[model samples]
Target: MALKILVTAKRVEDPESKIRVRPDGAGIVTEGVNYKLNPFDEIAVEEALRLKERHGGEVVVVSIGVDKSQTELRAALAMGADRAILVRHDGPLDPAVVSAMLQKIVEAEKPDLVLMGKQSIDDDQNQAGQYLAERLRWPQATFASKEASLESEAEQKKDPGVVLGADGRSLTVVREVDGGVETLVLALPAVVTTDLRLNKPRFASLPGIMKAKKKPLQELAAAALGVDLAPKVVVKRLSEPPARKGGVKVADVEELWKKLHEEAKAL
Candidate 1:
């Protein structure tokens, strides 16, 4: 049987371009900002695609968001996932709620390999992948930076570096650690979230975009998944940072020193 890989993606407001800020010291309103896929998730998708190429398998991209997320899902398909799945919603939910939704997706997919970005840039919670793994009772390797062989060196001396399981369960992954990389030879059906170092994401060409339309996309409601989409926490309001004022230029070194000692307090 071919290997199965599940990758999680997210559509987030692009922080690169400026967005409108609230006048009342509230957080920047994201209601109208242009959005893009989380960069780390893109790298995870790229790694999943590469693994499929190397070992021969199917890559399924999953995303949890409102209807606007379909654009991001389609983008994943255009990049080369065999299919896409969307856990649709209307607005932001707490990360824990999102993780609950993802647990349902994991139950449905039952993939040998589960992958996701380290964290979404928007929230930066970095908890979904780990939470999903815990919910599914699967071993997780987070911050994977490279593809790894799922075999021992002694075992690889005879056959391919990759090992096979009697029940079709085995995996090898390279993850990042405190000082450097840690290569983990683990059993299959594992959750592995990727970091930015995993791989460079690809651009979707026009032809690829056309091809993506043919790929299968399955949609599921959060309610249908038997999970409460209600948030455990709430964002009461948001605020923008205070604007900066121009600085005065000193006339000479002595003046600069005086200004530093008196006003700037550098002394």
Candidate 2:
């Protein structure tokens, strides 16, 4: 059967170094924060597109964010997604709650494969994808840095027979593990979150961008999904990390080694 893949993308501010504390200390208003697709999510999208190209299937890119997220969705379309969906919302949400919202989408789409980033840059909670899988009761494989193979019982009657790579069609996954490398392959109808080491995401060319405008984008409101937007976890406060002091450059290896062993506490 052809692949039905649902890949998620997110919009976040570009990486920055400036940090200015707010008057209330509730959050830091970083300067010159430009929005872009989350890096890990871009990898996830690239993985989905590669699989679609190799396996012969459609790739659908999805996102949950405010109206500004459309730009990221368009980028996904330009990168080769057959279609895109934007689930728009206004406020910040806990990962668990976001998972509920995704569950509704997965139920409606009934995709064979779902992909997402390992974590969002803004919160770094990394709980949304796993929670979505749990809610749907589908198999889940997190932090996948490589391609995933799929098989079905329906394939057993075929000529060559289906040879799935270990994880079965239920929840097998091949992912990155510590100490050099290891892969975990899981079953079908599963979720696979990605890491930075995955394939580089593509940029939309001018022609691709123009074509993307003609592509269809289905918008679904969070309330329509029967989910309460209220968050269960409340953030009582937010604060910035302590500032790092400028370090003096050592003139020689001896001084560098001395600094590393003594003041740096490496020794």
Candidate 3:
């Protein structure tokens, strides 16, 4: 039987967009900002596509956001996902709520695996994937990096999908750790959060883009999922970091040394 992989692709601000705190500090000003798929989530989609190509599977991408998130889901489909699901929501959501909603979807979809970004760039909370995994009581692997060493390129290519559990129903994941790298073997029906070096996401060719428009993109309401969408955390204010101070240009090494020793109080 072919594998059923469910991936997540979230809508986020363009990486280059300049964001500012709202006037009332309730949220960030999003007016006139460009929105795109979260970068890490794009990697997640790419990994899912690669796994499907290697293992013969169908990939389904999903997102939780407003109606505009349909565009992100379509982008994932354009990259070769079989279909997409958009959990339409317009208000703020805590990671807990998001996880519960995802759990409800998982119960309905019953996919073999769930792939998502290690963190969302917009908020950088880095909690949704872990929380979702806990809610589903499934194994999880995050910050997917490269294995420590591979004797051959082919071995490296095969590393991510290596099966080590009963009846070839497991996956071995190599991910980055604090000082070195760590490897883990997880059973099937696990959650995997992608990182930067996983794979380069393919651009949507014109043909692919046209085909994506015809692909299945289903929309569902959070209410339909039977999970509370209310935020657990309250945002009293939103603020940007303080402006960086200008640095002085020393005329020579002597001046630089003096400034470092005096102004910076260095040895």
Candidate 4:
């Protein structure tokens, strides 16, 4: 049976770029920051593509952000998604708002599965996927990862961490937990969030990049979705961590202990 999978592509500041909190405590300075698809979401897309390859279906990638987020959506297309959707919304959005928006999309698309990153690097809230699953009242599996190393040859040849059951009515997922890993079997039309070790995302080839331009990329206005976009959580301010003090060399263990106890008060 063919499956239709919905994956998410989130635009985030490149981790390599320097992030600076604005002087007014408003937000980060985006003047020179480069943006890229969130790493976890990339893994999710890869898993979706793999599932499509195995089960024979379409993979649709979606992004919610400013117009520039189309860049990330196109990137997902270049990586092998059948199509893309860009939900244009420019404003502060918390997990609640994002989940609500995604719920509307999910209803419209009616995909068999919703795959996305466990968390976005920028916010690292790790709540959107869970929130979305709760709002949709669907079974959810998160922090997906395989036991083998992602770089290992065996892992490269193995099936995706998220496996579709033989009946195609359920999904089996291996997910990371607090101390180890856990497995879960979810019924169809469930939500799954990818972890770092799920899969290594493939780069877009030159031909793929050219082809992505011709792929169907539908744009939608967030307001028209009829979902309330009111933010339940708000960021009051942003601030940088305090600078670390220079380390002092200790002449002896006793001196180190004294410094730790008195100067640093670590004791």
Candidate 5:
């Protein structure tokens, strides 16, 4: 049987572009900003497509936002997702609300596995995946560097390599830890969040883009999902980071050492 994988993507400001706080300090200035798929979320989409390719399954990509998110979802479809889903709303959504809505989608889709970026580049909360797993009472693996699975006792000694699953009942994944890696064996219907090293995301080709235009895309309202959207936390203000002053130059090593030891108090 083929595995069913659901991946999550989000629209975010192009990280390369500088972000500015609104004049009133209410929020970010988005009037003329460039928006793109979150880099981490794109990695999630790529990983889902790869899993579908390797295991012969369907890959579904979903995003939450206003109509603008449709473009990002279409980008994922162009990268080989079978279908796309857009949950429509026109305001900022907190991680909790995002997870709650995702829970509803998970229950509705009933996919065998869910793949999502470890965190959205815009908010960097890193909470949605974990929250969704908890709300659904399913196993989860986050910050995964690569795929893995623990074999059943009968197959434990067979090999120590990239095993997708053992007994077709559970999955083991390798997570990037502080200094090395950690392995986790999670049962089917699990959540896995991707990190930077997961894989390089592919760009949509000309042919793929044309095909994506005809692919199936479903739009659903947040109200239809029956999830509350009230946020627990509110953004008080948005501000830019402090700028650094130019550094002073020293004539030689002695002068540098003196400056470092005395002025900068290094020694």
Candidate 6:
């Protein structure tokens, strides 16, 4: 069955890059920081591509950020997305605002499925997918993964954890839960959030990268979408964790217990 899948690609600070809080505590120091596509979102894009490959269709990747976000969109295009859309906005964005913006896009695109990372690495808010689902009043399956397939490398690479119903009107999702995995059958036009074990993202080949330059990338202003960008949640400050103190060697378990109970008070 043919499908139109919409996936999100969020540009975030690369975890490997050195991150320092500004003196004023407004935000992180962006001077020399590096940026890349959010790893979870990369997995979402990979899943979308895999779904398209299994059941012939088109995959559309979208991002919301400054003009630089086009770089991430192009990266998704290079990974075999049919096209891209970018919502241009250079301001503070919270999960509420993002979900509102995505709602507008969903209304315009009307895809059969909306796929996104469970959360962005920079914020780690992990709320956008659920917020979007609620706003759209659609069924949702989050933390998608297949524990059984994950045990075998070959199986992990070959099979998709998310399975489409034979009739093509429902989805069978194997997702991670508190103690184990949980399965859910969601009707079509649902939202799904990807987890790390979903599928390994494919690297863009040289030819793919070259072709991506020529692919269609539509850019739209966030204001044009008519979704209010005012963030409901605001960050008051940013601070680094306190430095850890050097550990002291204890003579015995009794000493360790004494330190834990009296000094550390961790007991």
Cα TM-score of candidate 4: 0.93
lDDT of 2 at 82: 84
Better of 5 and 6 by TM-score: 6
Comparison by lDDT, 1 against 4, better one: 4
How far out, in Å, is residue 139 in model 4?
0.3
Over 61-90, each residue of candidate 3 has an lDDT whose tens digit, in order, gives 989999999989989988889999999999
What lDDT score is found at residue 98 in candidate 4?
Answer: 92
Q: Candidate 3, which segments miss by more than 4 Å at Cα?
A: 148-166
Candidate 6 residue-wise lDDT, 1-267, digit = tens? 988999999999997999899999999999988899999999999888888888888999999999999989999999999899999999887999999999999999999999999999998999999999999999999999876555686555656668889999899999998999899999989999999888788899899899999999999999999977889988999999997888899999999999999998999
Best by TM-score: 4
* Models, CA RMSD each: 5.8, 6.2, 2.6, 2.2, 5.2, 2.4
Better of 2 and 6 by TM-score: 6
lDDT top scorer: 4
Q: Assess every candidate by TM-score.
A: 0.81, 0.84, 0.91, 0.93, 0.90, 0.92
**Residue 110, candidate 6: how far off, in angstroms?**
0.6
- Which of candidates 2 and 4 reaches a greater lDDT? 4
Where does candidate 6 stray beyond 4 Å?
151-157, 247-267
Error of 1 at 88 (Å): 1.5
lDDT of model 2, residue 251? 100
Error of 2 at 240 (Å): 1.6
lDDT of 4 by residue, 3-113 (tens): 999999999999999999999999999999999999999999999988898899999999999999999999999998999999999987688899999999999999999
In terms of TM-score, how similar is model 6 to the real structure? Answer: 0.92
By the lDDT metric, which is better: model 1 or model 3? 3
Residue-by-residue lDDT tens digits, candidate 2, 67-119: 88999998888888889988988777688878898888888898888889999
Q: Candidates ranked by TM-score, best first?
A: 4, 6, 3, 5, 2, 1
